[model samples]
Target chain A: MTVHTQHINMTRTPLPILPISLGVLFLGTAITMPFWGQAYWLHEFVNISCFFIFAMMWNLLAGYGGMVSVGQQAFFGLGGYFVLAMGNLAGVSPFIGIPLAAILTAIMALPLSKLAFRLNGGYFAIGTWVIAEVVRLTVANISIVGGGSGTSLTAFRGVDRVFRQHMTYWIALTCVVATVALILLFLRSKQGLALQAIRDSEVAASSQGVDVIRMKLAVYVVAALGCGLAGALYFASNLRISPDAAFSVNWTAFAIFIVMIGGVGRIEGPIIGTFVFWLINHYLSDYGTWYLIGLGGLAIVMSLYMKDGLAGFIHRKTGKDFLSIKRIYRSK
Target chain B: MLLTVENAHKSYGALAVTKGMSFSVEEGETLGILGPNGAGKTTLFNLISGDVSLDSGIVHFNGQNITTLAPFQRCQSGIGRSYQVPHPFGNMTVFENLITAACFGGQMSEPEAYDVAEEVMNSMGLTSLANQQAGSMTLLNRKRLELARALATRPKLLLLDEIAGGLTEPEAQELVTELKKIKAKGTTMIWIEHVVHALLSIADRLMVVNFGEKLADGEPMSVMNDPEVKRVYMGIEA
Candidate 1:
């Protein structure tokens, strides 16, 4: 008689040294950009970082939570208005108002999700847009925040231009880092697992004892918080806020473009997609309408060929994930 | 009784799916439910698991009234179920699916859930395909994964809805073997199946439902020989 033993080795590998080292090298360059880089580069960094944060939030909400919202600008606009109101009226620093706006936006999201969650699929998308339009019109009539005419951020009026630019640049970097870290930590947690299950099938998730409604609501409010933070910081850097620009559907459009091109579900997709989007906008802005046309064409091609986005294509080819949450198992 | 359904009623606008049907199962007993198409077998499972709201009456599990509990709450309270059509989380691996059930439904911690998932996978003959994406699996594997995932919830009572519907004879026999092992471990079960031979092999008691009403209930062979059951299955007066 022969005896055989079967053994399975299931372990989570340690973080890859190469990617961590390369990531550190990139961070080193980014942190010192203000010292050696041109002012234009710093300004662009702030814009890219703001949009990156916004796109990340949208990706989490739509990709992970299965709540495809097209009206995230509702929170974005609200954040901008909140900061403007605080800076101009209450004499609070816009920097202080930025965080405060995020809180307020999250509180507002609680009620908004109730109404928005009632609709699913295409109707949900349209419903959110309608809500944003209502918000834009209401803000337009609020005369207190300059209404339709809009208002400029006055909290930074006394600060020097050099100091202001550096401060804004640092704030943008902080927000981007925080957003990525928070999401990475979240996606690695037990609750994050539950959220992904809910995304796949709400019925199956509930059968597994996940509090489906609670998980969805949490993701919705958290996404709103990130969006609000980005909106406040973006306008703070621009030093201007108007109902049209703040509440514009273009914000959501740009976010969708970035998420679609980079990959909707994966974390690294937004980072790669945002940079690609920024580069195209920078180089092709001179072409005016042709730039928009080219972007539209590229999006269509990407969707048809690479449904998972650029990051997904890269993953398929290289079998590497810069930000994967999937667990690995091995047998021996 | 481990599970008790008392005169539970349900309707979908013009259609009354469960017409005040009542039944109960003791702990560790396997109750086999045989029903014709659209005879409210699945609907009965849905009511017990809180997937559908009952128009009236109550459900008691482990001696507590669970009529008002949510689907998830029922799951947490030790009632687990498998769907007629598998509902595996397509993006997740088979192991992750079981982990979700263990962590949430079984109310275990992360490490504990992993242990439970591994055990369930091994017992269900799913250890070889643990890392496979559930959506890309064969129908047989999907069915096994569904049952494994539900079992990972550590339920006191398992409600299986047509788990044997689409399996080959050999595959069905293999499942029967696995299920018999689980029965030996003493988990209470209520299985609604079209496969009469498979149900007869393990069920201690047999029930027949027709037009949302209990047509017959007794021992497996006796229930099969019942004239009304013969009439219902034959669709003619016996």
Candidate 2:
């Protein structure tokens, strides 16, 4: 035993200096994009960031935590409405309101989880959608926020157009970076291990002393927080908020599509999928119904041919994870 | 006594699985349990470990009433259990599985858990399979991983449910040798097994249970020879 102990050790391989340096270089250039890049490109990036963050949250919930929630847009819609409420009612700047709106949305998830958690498997997915619809209908009846027709974010009315666009762009960039960094940290933590174990087998995890219910609830709330943050930032850029746009089921559909094509359990899945989704939307969106059909067909192909998605396929081919969180045993 | 179950009763509606069963285990004692297919043996283990809650009764662990504690809480309070059929976290490597049991069940920090996991893997002859995904392992290896995980918890009491149920004679003897090492360290154990010869080799005392009732409990040979035990468990006409 003593001899074996001397030779065996477990470790998380530290991030290589190469990726860190490359990441820093890319981020530095991106931070200065407003000075040299076109406004249209900035808008595109803001849109991509929103999709990436939202999809990442969905991946964390379903891919890692074994929770398949299709109603996350409830929090998204709530975030949109909350920011507008803060600006229209309390006169808070939309900039300040966006973060607060996200917090309020996270708090809302606690009670919502109580109801949603009562159902499991396919029922859970449907239950969340029902909850989202309930939230949307409830918000639509409130006249101050334009009811169902929605209203503009008037708080940004006085702010310079160029300045607002630049700040919004920067905020979106920040959200993407922060989301990636934080999720990476979480997946490497002990709680992250617990979450994955629960995902694999709740009974086994519980027998191993993991508080399965608590871990699931925590992941649910965190996912809601991510969705809310993305929603608020998204509408902040678009300068409008309405029940139909804010609570649209298409938001979740796009997120699910992105995660499925990219890879369900890998961090790179959402990032890669968002890029692919952006390319398709940018190039083929004008085709209308055909574009939607193409997406559905692509998702089917990906599921059938590449069960693990694009990132998983890439890993299988190259034997490398661009962003790995796996812990390995090392022999000294 | 290190553990005590008094009138433990559990049922699934009209079907009574454990009917007012009671027993106790002293510190460092290995109690071998013998029972027929539906004799509520596994159910008793569940009741003690808090996997299945008692319909009405009391469970005392280390002199503390723990009847209402959750399964995780029972584990935290120095109880460790292995399933009837091995239940490894399928996608995770064996080392990750052991680290989880040590970190959560034993309430150890990451570094401490890693060290314990390493030692357990080595002792269980699983160091070579540390990086192997648990679900991909053979049945015998899965059983070893299951026991290794339970040991990683550093439990004051270990509940093993048919750890050797499917092994060949040589394999069962190899496991007995491993279990003897654990016993030498004075850890209390309650092992449920149909491998009578294996049970006879290590169990300090033997117990026969039928329909959730204790038919006999005493020295190994005497308990095995009890007329009631033979008639019921061994299926010999009295």
Candidate 3:
């Protein structure tokens, strides 16, 4: 029963100081933005946070879990509508409704996943989109939630405009922090290792005793909750909700582009991708149709030449993952 | 008996891969399986491991009826197997690959899983490649990983499928040496291999299968010498 174990040590690569310092500095600046920065700046930050969080979830589901879904907007729309319902009808504050709506939206994924799980690969992706459309149509027909015309969020009627903006900004910031922290913790845990293994090969993972179905379902639900939160947060700021706007496939499309351009599977990919997206959107968005065409073309070029995205390309060239999730062995 | 399969039958659209196959292995026995390329050896492994459902039969492991259990459930119940074509978790490091098996298959806690992974790596000569990505390894290392991963599961019964298929003579000999160390540990093993000398070197008994049926079963040398086994497997004039 004896085996050699005298010299080898098992450990994860230590987190480097550079990214940690930069992250703290960024958080500090973000946290103080409402006090020192202009209202427009705060609004932009909220928008950026929503896009980043949504893209991150998509990355988790597709990049890590290997379930490429094109129908996440179903939950995103549900989140927006739920928050609006609770606020306009039930008298709950829109701010409190965000998380409550997100949880309820995640619960909705359970039954939908049963149907979605029945399809795999390309069919799964298309099936999700179909499910989203069904949800959109069903919600549109409900007169209470405003039907196809939709409803505007009225819970902010009595609140001061500046205070509400500040509160919304902080809440969005909090979500970004939580999403990053929780997903990071999950990826570093033993379950995360099992998840990546499942992604690489489901048959092989199952032979190693991983419950592939359960793992995939868990990931799908988590992504649903995250996307829901992003949706709720987004409409809360815009103060408007409509079936077409909320359930648009463009939400998932943009997230896909970001994940593809940043990196498909790495944590850092979404971050870089989101920033690049914001830059193009801020500057080139004024070009209208040309801007849309440019975005599509860029995605195609990136997929063709730099398939790894920006972060993956850097890792290949430098052999360094700035935020490494790999384990290392040291000999004592 | 540690493992038994009774009256197993499987077919795909009229092609019967396994037909009423039945066998049993005692505790601490190394049973080697021999057959031609299309003799349904891998299909038999799949049925026993719960990867492929039997058309009609019963699989008993440690006296439990496991015919209807899922593959992962079977693995957790102490049955571990390697695919004929090695399927390592490509992006994960070799150490991480073993850790995945040890954690879920062996049902060990994180620290205990690390210990098992490290031990298996040491014995399997994978310690030096602990940090190397599993996908990028040479074929020999990947084959070693295939065996090391199954070993990390700490199974009561191990099923190895053609683990020595694509290796050179010296490399296969090295693998046989490592396997000898494992067999000495008294683990029950069912090995499907075309490398006759390697199988004969370790197996306590041998079974020959063709057309999904057991053709010969007994001592390794005698089974190989059987006229029927020679005619079917070796294509010899009977």
Number of the top lDDT candidate = 3
> Where is the poorest 10-residue window by lDDT in model 2 chain B?
B226-235
Better of 1 and 3 by DockQ: 3
Candidate 2 lDDT at A72 equals: 88
Better of 1 and 2 by DockQ: 1
**CAPRI-style grade of the A/B interface in model 1:** medium
**Model 3 misplaced regions, further than 4 Å:** A1-8
lDDT of 3 by residue, A1-332 (tens): 11224423666667667887998999999899899999998999888888999999999999999999999999989988989999999999988999998999999999999999999999999999999999999999999988999989998999999999999999999999899888887988889988999989999999999999999999999999999999999999989999999999999999999999999989999999999999999988999999999999999999999988999998999998987777676544
DockQ versus reference, model 1: 0.51
Please give fnat for model 2.
Answer: 0.58
Clashing pairs in 2: none
lDDT winner between candidates 1 and 2 = 2
Tell me the tens digit of each residue's lDDT in model 1 across A215-302: 9889989999999999988888898989999999989989999999999888888989999999999999899999989988999998
Residue pairs that clash (backbone atoms under 3 angstroms), model 3: none
lDDT of 2 by residue, A87-138 (tens): 8788998788878888999999999999999999999999999999999999
lDDT of the structure predicted as candidate 1? 0.89
User: What DockQ does each candidate score versus the true complex, computed on alpha carbons?
Assistant: 0.51, 0.49, 0.58
Best by TM-score: 3
Which tens-of-lDDT digit does each residue in B1-238 have in candidate 3? Answer: 9999999999998999999999999999999999998999999999988999999999999989999999999999999899999999999999999999999999987778888888999999999999899999999999999999999999999999999999999999999999899889988999999999999999999999999999999999999889999999999977
